[model samples]
Target: MVYRDYNISIVVTIFISLGLSIININTINSILIFGQNNVLSDVVCEKPGIKSISASGALKSHPPKNVIDGNQNTRWSVSGIDSWVQVDFGEKRNICEIDISWYKGDQRSYSFVVEVSNDGKNFKEIQSTRSSGTTNDFENYELKDSEIRYLKIIVTKNTENNWASINDIAFNMNKEPDQNLSDPKTEPESPFIPTKGYGDNIAVAADWSCGTPAKKTVKNVIAMEPSLLVVPGDMSYDNTGDCWLDIISPINDLVRITLGNHDVDEGNPESLAKQYIDHFKLPNTYYSFDYKNIHFLMLNSETDFDVGSKQYNFVLNDLKQIEIDPNIEWIITVFHHPIYTTATKHSPNEKFRDIYHPIFDQYDVDFVIQGHVHNYQRTYPIVFNGHNPDTPIVTDQHKNTYVDPTGQIYLITGTAGRQNHELIGQANYNADQYKGFGFLNLMLSNDGKTIKGVFYSNNNGEIIDEFVVQKTGAIKPINPDRNYQDDKNDQDNLQSNPLDSLFSDILNSTPRYK
Candidate 1:
């Protein structure tokens, strides 16, 4: 049955209370509720039973059984890190989402991994993520896995204390689609038809060295299964980049990387850069690629990017050409070093900002993603301030949404589980920052008129930051005399990329992956 009223969402839980007399716990199937003005039709209200539960070791009063008792007040607590709670669902089911309410989850974040098993002996990792530190309410974690009988939650650590505790846990299974919803002849009419998601997404990160701290982050990216994977730099800090490459082998060919300071081995290049270049089959140290409607310019921060330099001229001409390209609607520049960072470990790069920022603004570069700071930060759509590089002129005042924003937005997405660098510098034009393990997922709308950027924390369902840009609308004009123009005659300063032709054949050659 379709539910049009917003209150009908309560029908999901209310269905159990309304029809418990006729329901059978032994059967797991969706009930077709007859109703008018529907939204979610053929909703599944039955959940499987928990046969048995065991924990690494539970407190005397708060036993593992408390988790299955369906009481939010009671909980199961363990001493500390690596503590686990396992459950047997008696039979296999197509699990898709898990809901968990942690003890004092509103106060602190809990880092945990979910593993599932079919046979009681072997378990496979389903998800390694954290809890939303802001809520004690049940946080729903979506999954995409086949039938599984056993489930386990391995608590890595908690931010607040040495206790790994949980108030409640539940699972949602993915049911077969309703025939009416699947058949083209029986398609229903609703608002969803027009706004359905067909947008392409690119997952980006940096400082992803192979370690326990980085494992969860890498797994999270694999689960995202983005159309493209771009790494700004600092892939493997461990001498050879093979370790990190092996971990991300599933999406190796689709990954494009920039040379970070670490990737260049602190002034010593070649070996480390070669690993990523050879492994991923990059065309050059710096090149351009077009994926869907978004054009990506891979800038090498380790090399010469100064004014009148080869790198500078390449960037100038690249932006100039992309400006006239009718097919390209969005442009993103990815590099290793952040020019506008407030992190004390690596403060802002004054020369880099003055040289490149205005150029980015000139070409209407929508977003810039950088690494090297080992944290996440984003600036409001701001134009370069010639008076003081530290202070940029804010073009759009809005925080999370933009309507054809005037200036360019810069982001430091180095939070790939490597470690958080301390932010000791002044927060002059900073918007927000997150010192956690995560990556940026930039999504282009199906209509090709909008783009959404979401910074997702590794393993946790927490979205550190989110923004939407309606590119089709008129740009909110900044100052009438605002100077974003920076022109350079680099017609002669051209380097040919055998891979990226005039039309940027990169998008055509590679089979796009989801």
Candidate 2:
């Protein structure tokens, strides 16, 4: 009896050792998707009542923390690393929207690739975009209805501004897809295309003078997808010694050139203007282009608005016809001189304002964007030479420090390749001065709900400044309220400012431009 008992005990011990060896082999094969930890098995943790699973197979009781440290969230800030985060739906769930929020200051550009896997070994890329990029805000995406057990978001580019402080991310899942959110009335199709297509209908303001930086700026803008480039003035810094042709020859095929102050004269002042008129193929130094129902008025700031000139007569005739286009929802006038500039480095051009503001006001022009101050400033939409508290002005006049109400929306987006001027810190604009060499990316959404102006550095692709203009129909002009409240003109009701108490999330730490 004792010998038989010993034999059974030996057999049981051998079987137990074999099971242990099999378990160890499986653990070694499991790979980690992020961090240094090994992957936990789904089968071992799959209890009958488990709801959700995080990176660890333990019961995920709390949501992920909003950790903003660069090292912790390095995926949000830099490039060349394949950093990623994963979300498990517990079971096959239909996801429609994903809301990812960053700290109020962590704006940067990076490409996002989303993937799904039932077995957690393979992933498929869905949608990708080069975000003009957003800082300190939430980016919401309405994805097509998808059933995903494990979802992964891989960050290809590092978040530029924030040290990687991503706050909270929520995966919105529904039993049934909400048709309203699925097909948003406001959201338009993707603005950027995979090919060498212009991102949107808006134009890029470029100046190819001041050496290679200008040439690089033009090429980068073309790559980013601009509908067209509007070189309002100053194609080159100095035209002396016949260097103008060399500077413009390379980019001429890519962009439509417009004459600027430096390009017209400086060396051969007598015939320089004629040389500019002949080479650029412009219709007498001023012309217009109609695209997707938007009218772009490219004017010569030197001639038309300078005392009495021939270009002035041409501008008058051009406005007469543009004003009558009922289909033209937006009128964007580009030039070199600013109508209302608060840059202490350069004074506002009273001469240009007197020449153009009347026509702009009479026609209810949507926006007037110019580049020449070598610094950047935007004014609220106010009438010319008028100061009303209710009016919108871009100057830093109010003690509250927001967009001026009683002024027109004027922008000086000049620093394409030229050196940025030091901001003069004074009482009026001491708090809101940005001196950097950068360019502007102005986008008008197809729905006409928002106008986004993105200011990125010329040297490196750093987005320095951003602002949005919300349109209220002709019913209310210079409304100081925050929200766009609708009012019946006959009923005498008006809404408040759409953005009453908002501030910019992106800070000016290292000025991106030269």
Candidate 3:
């Protein structure tokens, strides 16, 4: 009897060890491997009959057949009545935009409504819209936010009167699409919620680095609850080779990258840029997106800035086409080059200024964002064309002020998870400047009419800067004289404090694992 009892105890011990290993595997895989790759694995459960059951179709929520015709380019036609396109975000996210492409050009009157559900049995309509474009190709649409797990798109009628066909459907999330803010689901065994998230805010660090300290600082900043992460150029030293990729793992899903000059070399001047693309899937080196009512255009400074170049022409055409939206009240441009810097480290990219400033002026661009100089600086609205010092200025909103006749409001925010350099000098339209290693967290109101930029450090949850911009319809109010400009403000030009010393080593080294 004693030997039998001992055997039973040994069996239970072995089982417990196996279960613990499985749990650890799940936790590590969720955080490092599967989640970063945007892939979710199958879940298994025990059945009553002493068998294990595996769940399939967890990520296979593709649109149904006969929903949108992808081959026909003539008209929208429908055949099957029960077909519908469905998207499961794994959880609910702020529905910022939906991009669609229909094969039938000019044939279908694009109109659709969004129906959402938690359990997929019962559904409710959240928002509906008529076609925003004339052609079958439309991109970057705003979506509503709630506790949405399953999303269904149904086509009631089309211009072709047949069926609707689509080639691609891409969606964006404010933060994690699966993160539920109001309530959280947790396992009873663990005290910490596995899927905690940061709200929509940008992070900054006085002295940012890629070493352990910088890594910790960045992780802390991301933990503050930001919807996205924006790192100013100089992300890693020597383009930091492969090392930068690991440093960014914490905020990989919510990152957008712009290359600093340090990212490239004589051989592969675009290597760093290419690496960024390989790691993160952006539409292009420079592209545009319409979130809510705002139009955001990202540019490539290292690329061509002169007229006639492919990149330059693309920018022109992009702005021209974007003007079709009457609802677009604000235009924000992002790039790596600084066109309005007053720092003595280097001169402004005048060639770029001459090439693109006029187009921006013509289109009434409101905000221009750049990185490279390791400091935080905000500029009042001003023009670069050198046409009229008396050009009118128009402020986009109260916190975001611009010149009267009109130029663009240039903001330099490069202090995230990296080291900071002191501001050597000043500029004509300088509004605010700081030396810190942190990031900018921006929140756009549902309509995109108002935006708030919050700058904070991750080390201690200290908010160092904050500003708000409200759209006034007109990007430039039309300046009769060039007299309207915000007061040229200045602050102590101290070197931005470093987050921690350990980060420097990590950022400066090459990546170990691919």
Candidate 4:
């Protein structure tokens, strides 16, 4: 009887050991699936088995699932205002961040608020942004220490016809294991390095948008490998700030921009301007910077430009400072509105001409680059009365090269790519004009004494217009009786004539006293 009891005790001990082993296995499986210590993967939202996605309303073909389909080409679009889309993870999950790719995201700005919920009923606001404009790129926002299963994005405002569209949504979830692992033996590719020897070449363009002919122009510009890019105005026609950012972010650090009318079209102008300021990290709307031997002044045409206005005073002081700097050989002014445009659709802005042209003439500004007319126009070296287009006194008719010009040369190159081409009818002041998509490339010599302007057509990849401006010592007299040739190679033989005495005196006199 004692032997039997000993065998039974051994069996009991074995049963208990098996039970404990089963419990431990279950615990390990739980840790692997939903443990807090798991490493999060880069693309947690793309994982299968999402609970559900719902939206306030969806257009006929665009359902809310398009946002979670991991495809940027597809989108969920709603026609009404105050639309929203929400996603549920089925179980409580730790969401650390959310990313969104906008749809039709150009030229317009979008305003939205992000909220999170634990029970899918009581939601709490986590982040609110006034204007989130970007195209074909994901804008990520971080969520701090909050564990929730439901995420909702509410669109409260938009600059584009009250439509709400989102291309894709992504999540960075905490406590998620990274399933993607490459072979340890494989080597990684090297990063891209731009070619040298083109550092001083600057590319100038405006009114560019993604997925358009301008995109090809931008690609050409990148291929040229310019050191810097100057966009005068009218960046994205859709007012989608984010879209513009996405299109230009590849060269973000190299771009210098000025404001345009389209950039400030939101309900609250201050808020809209703030979006631009924050994105570019600009000191102010109108500011100046020095690059190489060129001094660049970016003005705001939409703002007040009266003599007593802040912008006017800023320009006055900035020009004064630039004039005294001996190192600055060239003064290039950039703004949205053209002071002198020959396009018949939109005439020259009289206010800008009245308030700022005098300052430009006073400083003998080298080049004034402007947009807003949707074409390319290069004027003859002209001196104006600061209030009239008909008053443009052509100081020199030396076609492509002006040797010691008496006044600033104005260029309207708003044809980077926007709308239909403006009618390029005949204009007396316009030396050359083209109604096509193109950009101006300015090559400034190292000494800053000469600038070569070349307008390249994106459609045909040909040079449409070209000019050279050379600065010599003092102003020389001009004679109207002498005929000037349009040939670029004949510049060296051209000389100032005695008949241009009046222009010579004006050039020699201080413009501040005029």
TM-scores, one per candidate: 0.55, 0.49, 0.50, 0.56
What is the overall TM-score of model 1 with all chains considered together?
0.55
Candidate 1, lDDT over the whole model = 0.64
CA-RMSD of model 3: 24.2
Give the Å shift of residue 124 in candidate 3. Answer: 64
In terms of lDDT, the best-performing candidate is: 1
lDDT of 3 by residue, 38-110 (tens): 0011111111110111111112222232222232232222343222456555654344234555545344444
Q: Model 3 off-target regions past 4 Å? A: 1-209, 239-241, 266-271, 385-407, 474-477, 480-482, 485-514
Residue 31's C-alpha lDDT in candidate 4? Answer: 4
Count of steric clashes across candidates, in order: 5, 34, 52, 17
Ranking by lDDT: 1, 4, 3, 2
Deviation of model 1 at 514, angstroms: 20
Looking at model 2, which ten-residue stretch has the lowest summed lDDT? 1-10
The TM-score, computed over Cα atoms with residue i paired to residue i, of candidate 2 is: 0.49
Q: Which has the greatest TM-score?
A: 4
**What is the lDDT of every predicted structure here?**
0.64, 0.45, 0.47, 0.61
Instruction: Write one digit per residue (lDDT tens) for candidate 1, span 1-514.
Output: 1111111000000001111222111100111111111012222335567789898887798878777667788888877557788888898765545677777767776666678898978988756556657777766443332467888877776665566677665544435432112233322232111122246667888877664445556656666667878899887665477778887888776788888766754222455567666776666677788886778888888777779977787788888888888888888889988888774556566778889988887788888889988688988788877787777877655556666678888999887755445566546567778776767877676377766677876534356777766665455545636543221123221232222231132122222212
Ranking by TM-score: 4, 1, 3, 2
Candidate 1 segments exceeding 4 Å error:
1-198, 266-268, 473-514
Please report how far candidate 3 places residue 461 from its true position, in Å. 3.5
Q: Runs in model 2 with CA error above 4 Å?
A: 1-203, 206-208, 240-254, 304-310, 386-407, 426-433, 447-449, 472-474, 477-514
